[model samples]
Target: MDATELQAISDTLMRIVTPDMTPKQLIKAARKEHPNASKRDIARAAFFSIIANADQDHGKAKNLQAFAIAERTQNGAE
Candidate 1:
């Protein structure tokens, strides 16, 4: 996807996710919100969102990064 599409997906994921959520929970929530999106796409958007927010929210970034890693691992894409 292009930068703008990626940003939009990231924004959507950020709105749906919380720091307390696990990787499965995050992916489930993302898939619920974006039923047509591929799992890899959602994971990529989530990763971008985590990095984008890292400067302002390190704790959240860490949690979300963990979720992304778990998602990647579960999908055998890591």
Candidate 2:
């Protein structure tokens, strides 16, 4: 997707996400909201949203890190 679409997806995910929710939960919710989006796209949006939140609040950094690790592991990335 393009930057605008990515940002829109990220914004939607940010609205639906909660601090207590896991990355898988977030992806499921995002998929429900955006049925046409690819799983990779949803994860990328979540990553960007979490990173942006981390930039504004350092407390979110751990969530971002955890999500990143989970995403990489799920994708079979090293």
Candidate 3:
């Protein structure tokens, strides 16, 4: 695959592994914690991380998304 395709795949995989972090939060946290790393690179890593932990159910993604949305709503109310 070309660099772009490979990067896209990498990003998706990372997200699958890190089911806890929303894509937006992952980008922000990665930038702050790894200042030298490109947001795109960090995102790709996170995606790969998720893929590594994936299962047939994808239950993790569903649960994480629900939790993230609820957290955002809770924080917004404060």
Best by TM-score: 1
lDDT of each: 0.78, 0.72, 0.49
Q: What are the models' TM-scores?
A: 0.75, 0.71, 0.37
- How do the candidates rank by lDDT, highest first? 1, 2, 3
Cα-lDDT of candidate 2: 0.72
lDDT of 3 by residue, 1-78 (tens): 345654554444434435565656655654554455654454444344345544643665454444445545655688
User: Local error of candidate 2 at 24, Å?
Assistant: 2.7
Candidate 2 residue-wise lDDT at 63:
57
- For model 1, the superposed segments whose C-alpha errors exceed 4 Å read none
- Give the TM-score ranking, best first: 1, 2, 3
At residue 21, what lDDT does model 1 achieve? Answer: 85
Clashes of each: 0, 0, 14
What CA RMSD would you report for each candidate?
Answer: 2.2, 2.6, 7.7
lDDT digits (tens) for residues 6-65 of candidate 1: 788787776766767876677678777667778788789879988898888777677778
